[model samples]
Target: MADEPDPQLSVPVGMFEDIEDLKATNAALIAEVKALAAQVTALADGGGADPGEALGGDEAAAGGEPADEGEAEAEQYPPFILLLDSPAYDDELRALIEWVEGVLVPGYLAEPSADARWCHLWFEHPVAVARLHAAWLAWQELTDPASCGYTGPSVWHRDHLDPALRELRASTGPFAGCTKGEHQVGHRLPGLVPSAWTHGDD
Candidate 1:
């Protein structure tokens, strides 16, 4: 009995199996890390293939082709504020405000004048909100190197920024009654003609 292995010191078969499993898992993880490192090195050396394609495989590298129509539409357009729910809208509005205050006002907005007016409470005006949100979306897309490349900023300035400013700050635009120092009190949207459908007219 003394020559035989002591039962007290014997390892469980299940324990050995668990250790083997862990070792295999660790090996797989190490291999994945090595692969990721190689990809990073390739990108650093300016390899021809896109990094997204390398990680996602050939399906993702299909020359920017989306897997489905819905995905394609989503990729093309940013989420519009009007389409969002209350919480999402609030979050988006906050981001838009940050961009407006931090980048737009300081960098592009000129001193408020009678000809080029601005309202302190511009958010209160629905038209102003819609216009600003559109411009902000364009700015985000055009400024990103991954989205539009080097010429994007120039195109954004010429097409999006200038037009939005001209419309919003025009004498007859949404900020018409506002001034440099004060918001327009008792501000009201322009009255619209009653809908023909509401009156049962063709």
Candidate 2:
């Protein structure tokens, strides 16, 4: 009976309950810390957009295929469209198409063809070039005609039209069969203006 008298003081039920609660809280905190670490990793890797980021795990955002950087770059600038540069199609045209598509298209599709071989190829498919030209004109119309300045076309015509570009146009490569008459009438592109196309955020 004397020893039993000190039971409440020796081990208080409230203290035991507090100890159990502390253990649970510590376990929960550990789990939360782990989850935060995973999210940090996810964010470091281009946050799931371009996998080329240093952290990796760069999943394409919005569930689409990862974009090619070169294609993206070419799209930013207007590249010279090589219509008749298929050498099996025509040697000069092939070289022109190769130069434009291989080198220029790799950058921006800006500037019209500058070389005679390129011009010849373009002339061979005048209709197509005309259509492209019309599109270019329309784009020019979108902006101030004065502001439609292109260094590539202007400079290439003025300076780089020598053997380098010429060789490219005439080099018996793949796209030599292009003709001047193909694009005589020109095809109407679907969305020439922003209002002509539908954009969906969904």
Candidate 3:
């Protein structure tokens, strides 16, 4: 005979649903708490909007349809602020890399500036430069009192600078990807000796 369905083995669906709901509710509370902390910090530093406006408590809720539009349109955190404000996490970290590669790379660093120091040949080390520039930009933005982000000098170094530079400076990073095996590289510096053999010629 087929085994009867084990009634004791099946948990009530409501129990799982309740657990998930509690998890989500807790996460939201954590986010709100961090946001509140950032608001307090920004105000203490003398730059952000009123704490009442930042918190959006029940008493501070908007009055009309236009207010709904404003709420929908407003950025909860600006992109640069999102980089260093880690207690309130962002899922769009990959998007920061994409924007850096797509925009900041081509626009700013692809070609060395005319006034750039000879040691600052960014095109030869695009990945490292890109990461550094991105980290530097995050530092400038987050440390500003008006950024309304929970970032200090140490926090910027720890959060924004450390991880990116670590990845970018690794051997498998962009320069290596573009240089090893059969890859062709165009910009050797003036004093560098020529390679004995072309990468793919043999």
TM-score of each: 0.58, 0.20, 0.30
Which candidate number has the best lDDT? 1
Better of 1 and 2 by lDDT: 1
Give the lDDT ranking, best first. Answer: 1, 3, 2
Candidate 2 per-residue lDDT, tens place, 35-58, comes to 556667777864743324422222
User: What's the lDDT for all of these models?
Assistant: 0.77, 0.43, 0.53
As a whole number from 0 to 100, the lDDT of residue 78 in candidate 1 is 59
Model 3 deviation from native, Cα RMSD in Å: 21.0
lDDT of 3 by residue, 47-156 (tens): 98887667665222322234445677675534432233344223344455555567545654433222221122333453454465568567656678776355576677
The reply for model 1, stretches above 4 Å from the true place, is: 1-77, 185-202
Query: Whole-model lDDT for model 1 versus the true structure?
Result: 0.77
Output the number of the TM-score-best candidate.
1
Task: Determine which window of 10 residues in candidate 3 has minimal summed lDDT.
Answer: 112-121
